[model samples]
Target: MSAAVHSERPALLVTAADLAPQALALLRDFDVVYAGKSPSDDDIARLCKTHNPEAIIVRYGKIGAQAMDAAPALRVISKHGSGTDTIDKVAAQARHIEVRAAVGANAAAVAEQALALLLACAKSVPHLNTRMHAGHWDKASHKSVELAGRTIGLVGLGAIGQRFARMALAMDMRVLGYDPYARDVPPGIEVVNDLDTVWREADAISLHCPLTEDNRGLINRDTLARCKRGVIVVNTARGGLIDEAALLDAIQSGQVSSAGLDSFADEPMAGGHPFQGHERIVLSPHIGGVTSDAYVKMGVASTENVLAVLRA
Candidate 1:
């Protein structure tokens, strides 16, 4: 594509610095603007004002009312992944702008990550690995928890949750799920209507829910207190779902034996954050759904979502 030809196309702003080539091919008719990684609300608003894009693809950063108001031509906001909490839906609706998400596009990757985290927490993988690396092998004293025949409670039985349940069942584990909105839940998953049952019964708890006003800090001090003592916790979902301070306290007090976290209350989890260097907690940089395959899937899904509205 010639620079002159590209400049003549309708503009599309992407929050991320880069996009997959496969997804870019679908945007041939649009001139895409890359908002460098970690773009602030001010940067996004400035870009929207300068570019006057017809659509925005949200992959990172918060998309607030200011950004929406700046782009008078903006008609849609498409999420590059399933989570849409970062985008201001109320503001978009008020502005008559449509919001769409690449729902389930990254399900497999995130589900697999949840399972990995569960196993890491249950079997003490990181701790053992670190010990071995430091030339301190205490194989005789180390006792790993076995998952077979143990109950695993899952919150939010969406695509990702259901996928993780299937994996857990294959490993000879009991699967209990809690999701009021889920319908036709596959066989073998014991769906419990009450979250209290999940907290009391499960040996391990995994979160696969989205972040919302009603469910923010769902795993706070009170909820943690209700959980079975020494329970393993894994969260590949939104960080707001869990209270970071409560989780740390639970770990320190032995209410939660171990935790595997892929997301945080804040992204790029600031330097010297409390979660840093915690032995019982294993952390990942919110990349549970960031696999290469998931990247392309999410990118394509987000691009298609934008086109659905723009070309309607």
Candidate 2:
């Protein structure tokens, strides 16, 4: 086959295997080449040799110095989601290649998913479903709590956290928030001064903070120890924020009632993963922002970010 032509508009290499067509349609002016599946680092380098795209969009997998070295002609990287942790920023900076993250585009969808997990965990939907499937009708024996009178503590008061607080208030749940960077907590949500304050006060705690070296594993055993005995935890944010082993141990010991995890430290968690058999945990295949609306928004936003850099 002839190599993908490098046109005047630009050639874009979409490294992600599952980018929606709508995202591609938005960038139709450019030549779009998709990797049949997620390409390995060497495969990406080989593709760069042939296609010579001006921009590359990556999702989920890491983009390291080796990948960058292979595509010196590449000017931009359009990250599909809010997180840029997987992209090698140091290499991009040194190479003078612009990198763009589609931040805030999927906050609403992700925050909504977090709340869904909290409610599902509290109501024991998975357990009830399993019972019904097993030829047992024990609905009457299972007790479920309502969110109306309970308290929800938000870990980060960023866009997603603030959005969650609004939803919680509408449900008549008390919302408490802790964010050192936030200027003021949203109206109707109580602003707490420290991380422990949220843990001690909340019946369900949702984490919405960014993952950084300092904040890695912030929700470890010690933090979980301070929470209410039956506190439901939701983390739609980055995976490194919670210590997976510590969380599993807490769940087994009944220190943590249940958890809703959208992101994991490792994606496509290996077969026979511990969480596979856990009924209490609500595990999404990182589909928090997998909605149609979020996909279009992120694509358009990243497109803009890319165009801005080229213009500059």
Candidate 3:
């Protein structure tokens, strides 16, 4: 609830309170609502009913049709990150609300995180650390492979994937990509039309693809079976790209040697997930795009989009 005196300003609702000061300063002219940690969909709907926000800044939360129904004044939904899976696009379109994303703002951060995950999986960093913490130091048992001579396959060569390609190339790794619409790929990477070749050839495969109805579970049992035996998997993209159940089975059978995942299909993964406590898997909360620099850039872009739509 607001404690300050009232003034004439546009109502703006931010679904997260962790927005940087740079982004907050941009919203000085607007009456803002900040959803604290562990926010819920019910909170969003309740806030809209209480304050009637004309614009919403969505940062990693599920906002449904109920929230839209509560806020009849809402004109636009601006996502702080690139993905739109959290927001209900079909419902928003039905309500005639403009939904947009802060694209490319967090590309570098996400790309860097992707490489970190890939390296961590290849070196078994998490496993070694866990063993050491448990007072067991068997150094020679865990073998680390050199990344220089191996082939790395990228599912999508968008902004983040392009950056990952550069990093891999710097380490002398051969990078292959599969993106049907990307016309101008970077100089070093080879973009291929055939998807099977990536699964068959890549020593390690990283996913940078978006999640869609047609592409959901793109890495299912059939696709995982097609991969080279003992292949490593990395995903810094949306979770829906890989079927968690299928991946778990592959890992158990040694079909997939290791995995580094930052996103999952049913997110905010509950305790005792299939990947957790596994020596071959490294997991992170979906925070690849949570850097300070990305926050400011995304926040400013989202605010700008909101303002543009409102002022028009």
Best by TM-score: 1
- RMSD of each candidate? 2.1, 2.3, 2.0
Q: Per-residue lDDT tens digits of candidate 2, residues 1-312?
A: 225675677667777655666666667677777765656777776667777777888764577787778777789987887888778888989998888988788888888898888888988888888888899988677788788989999988888889899999999999999888887666998998888889898999898887888999999999999989988989998899999999998899888889989889887778888988898788888788878889888777777777677668
Candidate 1, position 121, lDDT: 86
Alpha carbon lDDT at 148, candidate 2: 97
**lDDT score, residue 67, model 3?**
96
User: For each candidate, what is the lDDT?
Assistant: 0.93, 0.82, 0.88
Writing each residue's lDDT as its tens digit, candidate 3 over 117-142 gives 99998888888888899999887676
Candidate 2 segments whose C-alpha is farther than 4 A from its true place: 1-9, 18-22, 183-185
lDDT of 3 at 48: 86
Give one clash count per candidate, in the order shown: 0, 0, 0
Candidate 1 residue-pair clash tally? 0
- Please write out the lDDT profile of model 1 over residues 190-298, one tens digit for every residue: 9999999999999999999888999999999998999999999999999999999999999999999999999998888899999889888989999999999999999
Model 3 misplaced regions, further than 4 Å? 1-7, 134-139
- Give the CA lDDT, 0 to 100, for residue 116 in model 2: 84
Q: Between candidates 1 and 3, name the one with more favorable lDDT.
A: 1
lDDT, model 1, position 159: 89
